[model samples]
Target: MTQFTPDLASRFARIALGHVERRYPFKLDQVLLGPDDRRSPTELHPVFHGSFDWHSCVHGYWLLARIGRRFPDLPEAAEITALFDRKLTPELVAGERAYLDRPLSGGFERPYGWAWLLKLAAELEQRMAPAERAWAEALAPLAQAFADRFRAYLPKATYPVRAGVHSNTAFALRLALDYAEAVKDQDLAALFRHKALAWYGADADCQAWEPGGDDFLSPALIEAALMARALPAGAFVPWLDRFLPRLAAQEPGALFAPATVSDRTDGKIAHLDGVNLSRAWCLREVAAALPVGDARRGVLGKAAETHLAASLPHVASDYMGEHWLASFAALALETA
Candidate 1:
């Protein structure tokens, strides 16, 4: 077992807060500057590439929640959650009927409604004090709102799954499970727990598409393992134990690789490996959650180190001014 030094944790906190400040806009209530800021007309487009457009914002907000929990003294906590409520409240109230058709919405056409929201809320809840819960009363309501939406989607005829990085869904569900368990809402927690177990068992085929060759993809896998472990009886343990070693082995190359490009096909030749620091944090979370004496625990340690080493440069970057990668590295470093 390892604990990240205070200096490392502070660096992560700085980066996380930096990302939130630099990327987020109160007016838009979303992270990142629209393409309009750039001089070139052609440059005016979404900044990331993925199935869901809002994942960056979602990921950012979730990261912020963790930061908020880790450093409750900062006023950014209320500011962050307020921004989250601005963008997310409608969807929660919209229930299952909410569709991604809105040009601005980033989620894919799936039943992700409640699962992800609960995760965000849970992260926020972690930092709450007994006296502060009253001030944060909306947190529980917001979580319930997601539950209503998720339950609405549960009866669907068919659910489409992501082809790569199944961790997207897994983290969302894991967060939901975490939220449920922490909140002592047993029934709500069980719902997500059951669904996570079912998906993990059926997701063998999806694992093939994992960005195992990429460091960024490892975080998603960590999240998947986390959600799987969220179930009782060590449900996700065996497979998670099996998954880390190979991913950890790839760390040396992936870390040395240039930054991960935002758009793989843009032809601009950007490096983006640093953008995936969240994977390290997720890996640590999974490792911490696993039952002790499991063989995979050792592998988790190796994977955790690889992830931290990969993120070292960004954590040390004095000029980047706190981006997503910074906070993620901080959290992962803290967990490590």
Candidate 2:
């Protein structure tokens, strides 16, 4: 199986630190109410104005925190720490919080960015050095803002978003659950579990017609992984049985195969590489959640290996992919 080595961690850290503050080549997730709102990314976002977009930058910070905790002697640790100290200030966080309060910014990054901010906060909370803890404290209000968004939006969401992209409800919930469990937020955790069951509890026989050419996440597998996290072992096993009855047979052949990336230069096409890495992670999580003697364990395990092999090499090959793919690669190799 692929492992996260110190070398790999250093490499990914360098990639994130290289572009976390690059202002150009950015896609702002904001609404321009007037000429006054035409400010640059750094001025508007204050802290997260890099890695192409808001959510990716948030998770890029998450990758840095995760790797920094695991490999403290990393070459980029000082730089990462310095960046956090400079950027993750109370003033900057207040600016970010204010952005969320804007009338037109209600849907800004919504569940996707919201989830990543909480995940970053969770990482910082778990691995609290004196300096890092200060940064984490500074970021709490922004994290709470997103948490409030989740509490407000989920109940009103009549139908879950089943897309294989950033808007996917399962993907957001999985990450949010990680944050909730990390912080011992029982109310948030219970809310996520309830909503997940309501949205996907009855889902079965997923056709797995996915990889929409510009896709990243595996809708069926991510939902399965989320259910695996939310449900107990006994309940999960039965749920998995009903949801993916043909896993042993690999009926959804697409799930086993790696997506083909014809162009890495194009942003949307580059998403296929993300598909492979994310699918690898979801499959690994699902396989690990299964009973030891389950027949589908071997199937999911092999498919996870296949997908990892397909995308691990291309994580830092191009700017288009490099700006964000390392985070997904890290997620694929991360242990639960």
Candidate 3:
């Protein structure tokens, strides 16, 4: 296997260092931290403020995990670690907690938070500092609580999910894998594995389930591959290979030419419209995890370049501020 070139590695290192140093322990208690705090749902071009939402937080967790992996001297690493710990505080979410419901678009809030927190906690332990074992341990209960509540909540749940909502559930499966691996709970992890597989198998009518329509389906498949790897199953490999390239090939200039929507650069892409930075980053993430090879690296490079060229310039003043754009820029730079 070829080693990662110094240029690419250095770029990754810089982004990781930048992310840990720049991002922070701003606000964890408030469910919705408003756009000013670097968190938001709908982003308006040239405005770029932060708001609190499940998608943004999950994206944060995703970037932080990667940063912790590449950068050794990350300043905000500890603060991020603590922020995750704070998320587990049962004291804040005192009332009834719901699970499994597609709460991303507003059904319930706890599950999405737990999935992301658990994922960030696990990544912190694995790549940040092994010495922070105790800190990571503190968040396990929160993950377990989330899973329990989710199981309790999904008794009569619906399926065939849309892009935004289903992706959150897919994230929950990934978090379940993380929690299971970190806590060494094989049985619990297996249950998550089973659930994810079952969900994927849902009929064509299932909105949450994708039978290879590409775009969003590719990222979801990559995530499922991650879960499968953690749980050790061979089934996910083929689908992953099938979807990665399709997702990677989509470019920007082609879109503004053949478009139904009037202005593609408006920057308020939530669901539909076939293009969003979130889905593109998912491919970047999966490529990062895979063994470094010329083919794989090329795929990542293309994904990074496409996204960076189209999205990076918009980051500084966009409505969602620089958070998501910066995070994805870092990922793209890493692959480049």
Candidate 4:
């Protein structure tokens, strides 16, 4: 399994810091109202206005926070600290909160960015540094706002989004659960458990018809990972058997192979690299959750390595991929 080393940490940190505030080449997720609402990305999303889009920028910060915590002596640590100190302020957080108040803002980044914000807060909380803690404190309101969104939305989310894209519910719920567990939020954790069971408990025989052109997530694998976290080991094994019945044979060929990216410069096509990285992490997580002697464990582990090898080198291949891919790469390597 690939590990996150100081050199890799510096590489990812530099990528994140380089774009967190770049402010250009951005795609804003907003509901414009007249000319006044047609504003620049920074004007609309004060804190998350870089890395091509809101969710990317949000996770970019998450990557920096996570890497800085793990490798405190890295050269990028000081800059990461300074960046958080400057950006994660009460005023900026308030500004970010206010944006959610706008019309049609409920769907802005929806569960994806919302999940990353909570993940960022959880990372800072885990680090337990006074300065980092202060940054997390300042970002608490924003995190709470997202948590409230999840609480309000999940009850009404009658169907789970199985897309291999940003709207995927399993991916968001998994990240949110991490934050909930880290903060010891019993209410939030209960909500996640309820929703996970409600959404996926009856699921079986995943087709794994995935790797959509622009997909950066494996809907099948993400759901499996969520079940791994949400269910007890004994229950999870049965669930996994029902959901991926042929995993022992690796019958779903898509699950074991790495996705190919035809164009790294094309934003949508570039997502294949992310797909590989995220699939790597999800596969590794699923493997870890299985019984030690399970035959599927070895298959999943090898598939993870294959996927990691396919995408790890392309993380910084182009500006389009570089702006966001490092974070997913870090996720894959660190989780392994």
lDDT of 3 by residue, 46-82 (tens): 1101223443445555565555556535565565556
- lDDT for model 4 comes to 0.90
In model 4, the runs with Cα more than 4 Å from the true position are none
Question: Each model's TM-score?
Answer: 0.61, 0.98, 0.55, 0.98
lDDT of candidate 2 over 1-336, digit per residue (tens): 888999999999999998888777999887788889889888889999998888889999999989888999988988888898899999999999999888799999977888889999999888656877898899999988899999999999999998989899999999999889888999999999999999999998888998888888889889998999998658998888889889899978888889999999888999999999999999989988988998888888889889989988999878889889999999889943
Error of 1 at 75 (Å): 11
Model 3 lDDT, residue 215, Cα: 32
Provide the lowest-lDDT 10-residue window in model 1. 41-50
Candidate 3, RMSD to the unseen true structure: 8.8
**lDDT score for residue 135 of model 3:** 44
- Name the 10 consecutive residues with the lowest summed lDDT in model 3: 41-50
In model 2, the runs with Cα more than 4 Å from the true position are none
Over 4 Å off, model 3: 1-69, 74-107, 127-131, 153-160, 165-168, 202-233, 237-267, 270-276, 284-304, 319-336
lDDT of 2 at 14: 91
